[model samples]
Target: MTLELRCGDVVTGCEGVVSGNTEEEVLTAAAAHAAEAHDLTTIDPATERALVAAIHPV
Candidate 1:
């Protein structure tokens, strides 16, 4: 099964949806997307937890 995450679920107003074969892959892509599109350079532990929690099987 593929893992999926909607950027909007974590970041307000974002319409991006990222999916991957594993959580690591989704996290990596989400990190890149956060930096490139949201100007978010770093993710704190709390936010990281949130990101992980937001991921779901699709």
Candidate 2:
């Protein structure tokens, strides 16, 4: 399964591949991606929480 990631109103997971066998790992990977590739230093806390919550279960 693929996890759809939305930044604000922009969807970023459509053309991308998500890694991890579980939701938690997937979101963790995504956070690493955001920090590494996107340089998102000010990413919203709520958004991060939601991402972790939504994607952390497989």
Candidate 3:
């Protein structure tokens, strides 16, 4: 089962999507991309919750 998450879905005015075999893998890559691309060093609890909630099976 693959999991997908789109940055555009969680963040406003952004267009990015990521997918992986597992949720943890997707979140790790998404976090790194968020830091490098969006300059988000740390994800707060609320944002993390939102990210997780935005994840979908693909």
Best by lDDT: 1
lDDT of 2 by residue, 1-58 (tens): 5554433223354344345766666777767766766776555878777666545222
Q: Which portions of model 2 miss their true places by more than 4 Å?
A: 1-15, 42-46, 49-58
For model 2, name the residue pairs that clash: 23-55, 23-56, 24-56
For candidate 3, the 10 contiguous residues with the lowest summed lDDT are 10-19
Q: Order of candidates by lDDT, top first?
A: 1, 3, 2
TM-score of each: 0.93, 0.47, 0.92
Which has the better TM-score: candidate 1, or candidate 2?
1
Clashes of each: 0, 3, 0
Query: How would you encode candidate 3's per-residue C-alpha lDDT over 1-58 as one tens digit per residue?
Result: 9999999998887888889988899899889989988999899999999999999998
Name the lDDT value of residue 8 in candidate 2.
Answer: 27
Model 2 misses residue 13 by how many Å? Answer: 9.0
Give the runs in model 3 whose Cα sits over 4 Å from its true position. Answer: none
Model 1 regions more than 4 Å off? none
Ranked by lDDT, the better of candidates 1 and 2 is 1
Give the root-mean-square deviation of each candidate in angstroms.
0.7, 4.5, 0.8
Cα lDDT of model 1 by residue, 1-58, tens digit: 9999999999889999989999999999999899999898998888889999999999
Angstrom error of the Cα, residue 41, model 2: value is 3.8
The lDDT for every candidate, in the order shown, is 0.93, 0.56, 0.91
